[model samples]
Target: MFDMIIKNAKLRNAKDLVNIAIKNGLVKAIERNIEGKAIKEIDAMGNLVTPPFCDPHLHLDAALSVGDPRYNMSGTLLEGIQIWGERKPNLTKEIIKKNAIEAIKWEVANGTLKIRTHADVCDPRLLCVEALLEVKEEMKDLVDIQIVAFPQDGIYAYKNGDKLLEEALKMGADVVGGIPHNELTREDGVKDIEYVFELANKYNRLIDVHCDETGDDQSRFVEVMAKLTIDNDMEGLVTASHTTAMHNYNNDYAFKLIGILKRAQMNIITNPFDNSVLQNRTDGYPRRRGHTRVDEMLNRGINVCIGHDSIMDPWYPLGKGSMLQGANLLMHYAHLSGYDQIYELYDMITNYSAKTLGISNEYGIEVGKPADMIILNAKDEMDAIRLMSECLYVLRKGKVVSQTKPSISEVIFNGKRENIDFIVER
Candidate 1:
C-alpha cells in the first residue's frame, strides 16, 4: 500500500524507466517493478522525473512591478533601481503580499517548489519584510519559501540601513543579505561586508550578499566577503550573488580570488536573466562580458548555482517565471552546450541550488527523501531545457499539487496531419 505510485519514469540520466512508490509523504521504494496499490497513480510514459526545481535567488517583493510608475528609460541597472525606489513608497502591505503570492504561484506552476527570496529592508517601515513573512507562512503548503533580509540600498551607505535589516531579522527573516558593491565608497563597501558578516554571526544566520554585481573591474568586494567568511569560520554558509565584476578582473586576480572562494566554501550565484541585461550597461564597446567566469569556476569545482533574480520587475522587464528558461539562457551564456555540460546545467537549478539554500537533506527524490518531484514532458534534461518542457505533473509530499499538459502543434505533412512533439531525436 502507498500514497501514490509513479510508473515508467525516467529519472535524470537513467537509462531505463523505473517505478516509484510513495508512502507517508516519502519515497518508499524505487525499482524496475513494484507491487503497489495507492489512491492515485501516475503514468510518466518514459518522461523525465526529477526533484522539483529550486531557485535560490529572487526578489518577490519587487516582482511584477515592471513599468509601474515609469519604464526603465536607459535600460541600465541604476535607472531600474531608481524606478524601484519610486515605487517603494507607494507600496502597501496588501500590494506586496498580493504580488508576491502571484509570483510564487507562477514559479510553482513551473515546478519550482523551493525558493529563497530577498525582501528589501532598506525602508524603516519594513513593509516588504512584513508582507513576505506573511506570504511565507501562508504559502508553506504550496511552496517552501525562505525570506532573506536584503538591504538593497546599502547596509553601510544608507542611514539606519543596518538597523532596518536587523529589525527584519527580528521579525523572522531567515537569511541575512547585503549589497556591498553599491556603496558610495570602496571603504564603505568593505564595511558593508564586515557589517553583513557581523550581523549574520550575531543572528546565527546564513549570508547572501549582492557583491560586485557591477561590470567595473575594481568592484572587488567579493574578495572581502570571502575573507570575512574564512575569518569568521562561516565557510559554506556564505554566498556572493552576481559577482559579474569577476568577468572583468585580470587573469591573475581572478585566479587568486577563485582560490579564496574555494577555501571559504562560499557559494556563487549567477543570475543569468537579470545580469545578462543589467551588466555591461556602462561599457562603450569591444568584448564586454556581462557574466562571471562560469565555465572556469565550474571546471574548478566551485559550488556555483543559477538564480532568476527578477521577474517582470524594474530590473528585468521580461520573465515567464521559468527556471528552464533561465537555464536555457545560461547554456548559451556559459558555453555549456556540450552533451555533459548540458546535463550539468540541470544540476545547477536543482542540486546546486539546493546546496545554496542548505536544503540538500530533504530536497531530492531518492528513497527515504520526501516525495516531492515533477514529471516533465521531455524524456531527459536536454529536451527539458531545449523545449522549456512543460511539467505535466508536480507533486509535493506525495500529493499532486499541480498538473498540466504540454503544448502540441498540428500540421498537414504530405497530405497527412502530424504532430510536432519537439523531441530532438538522436
Candidate 2:
C-alpha cells in the first residue's frame, strides 16, 4: 500500500485533475487516477496544489527580537544595528534556540519548509550560532534549515571579528555571510568581501553575502561580488541578497552591472517587505521605493527571488513568515500587475526561491521527487495571490505536518441561497 494519496488536485499550470501517490517518502506516481489503496488520503477538490514554498533569506537569530530594550524611533538601518548591538550581550543559547524554534514553527505552518537563515556570529560568545546549529539538527526532519555565519556588525569594524567568523564556520555553519555595506569604509567593505570569499573557498561552503543593502548609489560592492563569483567559478553557489543600491544607479551603470551579474551567474534575492520601509528614510518627498530593479533584472534573464527578511525583528516590524505576503508586496512595489506578471510572482516565491537556496533538485511535484508539497485553498495562481491563500494541507516527506480548513461564508438574500467564494466571484 502507498503511504498517502491525493486525488483530483489541480496543478498551477494545467486545467486537468491529477492523482498523486506517495510511498517511502517519495512521489510514487502522478497520473489521472490510481487504483491502489493508501493509509491516508486527501481530496484537493480542484484546488491549487504546488511545490512547498522556500524562503531564500532570513535572520532567525534576530527574529521575534523586536522592541527589546527600546524601539527603532529613527526607522533607519543604522539605528537597527545599534539596537541589535545593545541586545547582543544579553543573548543566551537557551533563549536564542527558543526564539529560533518558535520562528520555524511559524514558517512551517505557512508551507515554508526550506529556509536559509543568517545567524549572528560577531558576538564573542557565539551564543546565537551555537543555538541555531542545535536548532538546525533538532528540526531537520520537519524543515531544512541552512545556517549562515552572519556578521551583522562589519567583519573589519570590530576587533577580532574576522577570527570569530572563521571560528563559526569551523563549528559547522553551512554558508559564509557578510554585511559589506556596514563596514567602516568602502575599501574596507571590499576587503571584507574578499575575506569571506577566501574562507568560503577554504571550507568548501556556499557564499551568501548581504551586499549593498543601503540606498547609496555609490555603494558598488555588488560588482566586486560578481567579479569574485566569476573568478572563483562559484556562480550558482553564490547569492547576493538585497542589492537595493542598484535601484539608485544610473541606467547606464545599472545596465553595465547587470551584464556582470549575468556573466557571474550569481543569484539575486530581494527583500521587498523590509527594503521598502527600511530604506529611503533620508528622503523627504518623492522618496525612493528602496527596492532593487526586479523587473529589469528579470528581463535580463537574471534569477531573482523574493525574501521575507524579518518577522517581528529589529529591521521590520511586521511579518508572519508568509511567502505570499512577501510576493504581494513585491507585486505592488515592482509594478508587476499584468496578468502574466501575477503568475510569475508566485513562481518567485516557490521555484525561483528554491533555485536560490540550491534545493530545486529535491523540490517539486513530479514523480520520484520528494513528496513535499502544499495544497492551497484557491483555484489558481491569481486567486492564490489575491487571497494570500490558506494552506489546506502541508506535506513534508509524504507526511502531513499541518493542515487548516478554509473559511466558510453563507449568503442568503431575498430567500435566495448562494455559495460565497470571494476569491472565485470577485
For TM-score, the strongest prediction is: 1
Each prediction's RMSD to truth: 1.0, 1.4
Clashing pairs in 2: none
TM-score of each: 0.98, 0.97
Q: lDDT tens string, model 2, 1-426?
A: 999999999987786999999999999999898989999999999989999889989888888888996888888888988999999988888877888889898888888999999988888888888999999999999999899999988899988889999999999999999989989998999999999999999999999999999889999999999999999989888899999999999999999999999999889999987899998889888898888999999888899998888988788888999998888888998898998889999999999988888888888999999999999988888888888888999999999998987778889999998878785454
lDDT of 1 by residue, 1-426 (tens): 788899999997688999999999999999999986888888999999999999999999999989898898787899998999999899999999998999988998899999999999999899999999999999999899999999999987778998998999999999999898888888888888898888888889999999898889999999999889989999999999999999999999999999989999999999999888888987877758689888888888889998999999899999978999999999998788999889888999999999999999888989999999999988889989998989899998998888987777998988999997866577
In candidate 1, which residue pairs get closer than 3 Å at backbone N, Cα or C atoms, i.e. clash? none
| Residue 385, model 1, lDDT | 95
CA lDDT scores, all candidates in order: 0.91, 0.90
| Residue range with the least summed lDDT across 10 consecutive positions in model 1 | 281-290
Error of 2 at 108 (Å): 0.9
